[model samples]
Target: MKKQIRFILTSVSILLSMFCGLENSYSLEENVKIEECSDLNCVRSHIDEINKGIVLLLAKRMQYVVQAGEIKLKNNIVTAYDKKRAELVVNNAEEFAKEKGLPSGFTKEIFQVIVDKSRDFEQIKMDKKSNLDKIKTKK
Candidate 1:
């Protein structure tokens, strides 16, 4: 019974250590910072503007993706092309964020959101095209 108890405790300790290490790996301590702005309202406004710019860039990227989808459909190309493009966008965004002194995790999250949105958009476009084809066939 004593030996069994020690073995259980040692197993628990190893599990706990592994869990802590995994948690630390996912922690964003180095990626995000919160600091008090001297001019709170002004700083907020500036940040908002910067966010808007990023949004605009995201929009442009989505537009390009949509166009690519259209071209792919016309040329009998596969979604693999789009997947490659999306991966490049994510990589570039990560590099850009690091160069701009932005948090890499935050930047990556934003890009992932963009990628999700683009995928949704592409799906909708494909669905519409399929529907249109059905309508034409019916006609």
Candidate 2:
């Protein structure tokens, strides 16, 4: 229950931050009248800003992923990969993509990469914990 609540809260915070950041960027661009992007350089500049924002959001998401891995390790969860959770995540991403007029396949592929990396990180955390325990037991 606690884990579920924590997960939900983390998810909510992520969504909130994404939307807030998007809102700010949208408004800023609107103020600058850069949405039209008449020239190649202007379009490239806008793309650069978008990429930067995406990278920032991904960094924030990974921070939460580390926290989640720690929580799972402390709670004695055995595996980093949760099939049901992964499916739910993909499904949610697909739905969001539909709402935003993005390609479902593109969204699914992107999320699969994110989920795979998250699992790798979680496994690393679990492995580190296991190693520490083995060392402690030896002494």
Candidate 3:
């Protein structure tokens, strides 16, 4: 069972490293550097880097959400919040967190916040596009 879990994690890590498309972003092990932590200051620095990385990832994700909003508008989808998809995302994050020995509920909460904000950003993008269309039509 341990081997299986390790294998799954390895596969996912490889895939993410290859396809995540974030330049200069380190993997989990590289980002943490537990062995190199000689003092509290070193640990704090690592934490800061990890936090910055999280923000960068969130920004990148929002960029895609913005594009998705535009595509939704073009295709006449008319809805920013897809309940099913949001649930799936949170569930998946929870499961992954469990596999990584993290608190599943905490992971679920974090993902829920992300999804809510993403929905809001998506809605805002759609509204701006709609307003632009209205202005264009009036001209």
Candidate 4:
């Protein structure tokens, strides 16, 4: 039947769209350019320090985002605010990179992954809190 064929085609299209949506969230580029340096040792040391700084900064930002999520839950703030805060984290990371004479695009790509992970963590926290609240209400 034509209706059955159409239904199957529509289902396939929806599934493919979902898959593409997930893939688009991640960075697809494999290579990122770093500034060329004549002193290999200096470059290596600087990169090490930069990496440490980025990790520390990201951890601090995630902590704040988690705290914000808790406050949002308490106050019933909209989810869009939480997503905006995550975007701010990526923006800050890119600014930090530019300040340090590093490539902004590369740093932004790195922070995109960080943002995605933070969002996942925030979602898990939100889910657990909602479940706990439901249990309390039921008791």
Candidate 5:
């Protein structure tokens, strides 16, 4: 499990690094090696890089969710939010957060936002596909 997590994180870091088109950006290793955060700007800089990576990773994740929308449409699920699936993700994240010594509530809240965005994205894709199909049928 630890190996799997490490591999996944590494993959995501590579994908985020590429997607950000940040060939000129400071190397992540150099940026993360803060000896000490003595200044506000120092901490903010780290936060900025971390947030940028998170944003790119989330965008890629959303792409998968859009693909899931196609499958849901084909299966007649017709809803983006599968309660069981959402619960599974939340529960896993909550436990992982606890294991990592982070605040469970904060982690859960973040996961909730992610799940909400995923559901909305999927719905958007589903709607677009439906419209395209309608147009083809009409023609």
Candidate 6:
């Protein structure tokens, strides 16, 4: 019960932070019953659900990163990679991992992958826009 409440509150907080600018306030469905994890199967199921939520958040972040690339292009700046920001993100993740009793090396490595993928995502966005511009010029 406690874990469910915590999960709901955490979800709510994330939703509020991400979509605060929007008009409607989001919330978890009141009709859904959150079950307690009493067995290994139940625990694994919850873990899977949590993983899905994390992936969703990552997808949203990717959208924002692409948008940032568009803004950078508009400003005549290249949005390939930002070394300082990447380093800061990994450093912060390492610190958080340590707090959660996770190995720093493993966390840093995972974050490195995330940073690399984020760079690729932004690059793809910038490249696509640039190609369209080139096609327009050629026409």
Regions of model 2 farther than 4 Å from truth? 1-34
Winner on lDDT between 1 and 2 is 2
Tell me each candidate's TM-score: 0.59, 0.71, 0.75, 0.53, 0.70, 0.69
For candidate 4, list the clashing residue pairs, or say none.
none
lDDT of 6 by residue, 35-110 (tens): 5446768655655665577668877988888888998899887766989999999999889756544444755766
lDDT of 2 by residue, 56-80 (tens): 8877988888788778878988578
1-139 per-residue lDDT for model 3 (tens digits): 3453344344444434332233244333435323345676865565555556666787899999999999999899878999999999999988976665453386676677779878988998899899999999999
Q: Scored by Cα lDDT, where does model 5 land?
A: 0.67
The lDDT of each candidate is 0.58, 0.65, 0.69, 0.58, 0.67, 0.67
User: What are the per-residue Cα lDDT tens digits for candidate 5 across 1-105?
Assistant: 345334444544444344333434443343433334567686556556666777688779888998899998888777788999998897898787565444447
User: How should the candidates be ordered by TM-score, best one leading?
Assistant: 3, 2, 5, 6, 1, 4
The model with the greater lDDT, 3 or 5, is 3
Residue pairs that clash (backbone atoms under 3 angstroms), model 2: none
What are the root-mean-square deviations of the candidates from the true structure over C-alphas?
15.1, 9.9, 11.0, 15.1, 10.9, 11.4
Top candidate by lDDT: 3
lDDT computed for candidate 3: 0.69
Runs of candidate 5 with Cα error greater than 4 angstroms are: 1-35
- Global CA lDDT of candidate 6, please? 0.67
- Taking the tens digit of each residue's C-alpha lDDT, what string does model 4 give over 72-120? 7888763523557668877997796565444447657656665676677
Best by TM-score: 3
Q: Which lDDT tens digits does candidate 1 get at residues 1-139?
A: 3453344344333332333244443212354343334675855564455446555775697788778777777776545235676788788978975664454465565566567667777767866776686799998
Worst 10 residues of 2 by lDDT: 25-34
Q: What is the lDDT of residue 122 in candidate 2?
A: 77
